[model samples]
Target: MSTQTSLALWAPRLLSVLRIVAALIFMAHGTQKLLGFPPGSGGGPAAMSLPWIAGVIEIVTGVLLTIGLFTRPAAFIASGTMAAAYWMAHAPRDFFPVNNGGDAAILYCFVFLYLVAAGPGPWSVDAKRR
Candidate 1:
């Protein structure tokens, strides 16, 4: 097959890889906040507080996105959460993302936004259901 055609054929699988990897990382962040999986960091957020609520959102959306169930909506919510996180929590620290330590947040925001547009791709529950 032509190189272009070969690349195109693998694109969907690559997308699935991206979705799975990103979602897993995102979920890890939530767990760190809510479950303190790695320990030694800090306690979970206070109940009903903003960080607590955000942790909830992150866990839920991360699972949905990871499984590619309700992928679009999940990604949309994830993207929004990251956007808010960057602006409210990170941006104030500095104008540049690196200085603010918001680089990861910004990356997550755009990556999830891309997933919303791209759908779950192949090997996803959404694809299976369809």
Candidate 2:
């Protein structure tokens, strides 16, 4: 196959790889907030607090997305969470995402948004169910 065609053939599989990697990384952030694994400078959030709540969502969505189960809805929720995180926590610090440390949040939001529209690929449980 031509290079272009070869790349196109691998696209769907690459999506799965992207989802798994991103979800795992996302879960790590949640773990830091909830379990304090690898230990941050301080303890986790107070119970039911915003950070704690975000951590919960992150873990749930991360697991779902990683497994390719409930992929679209999970991605949608994750995307929204990242968006809110950027606006509430980062944007207020600075207009520039780079200055505000919102770059990763923005990237995650857009990537999750893409996954929502794209759906999980043939490697996903969602695909197998169809």
Candidate that would win on lDDT:
2
Report the C-alpha lDDT of model 1 over 35-125, residue by residue, as the tens digit: 9975747688899988888889889999998899999999999999999999999999999998999999999999999999999999799
Report the lDDT tens digits of candidate 2 across residue range 1-130: 8999999999999999999889889888898899997588889999999999999999999999988999999999999999999999999999999999999999999989999999888788898899
- TM-score computed on alpha carbons, candidate 2: 0.97
Pairs of colliding residues, candidate 2: none
Query: CA lDDT of each candidate?
Result: 0.93, 0.93
Candidate 2, superposed: residue stretches over 4 Å from native: none
lDDT of 2: 0.93
Model 1 scores a C-alpha lDDT of 0.93
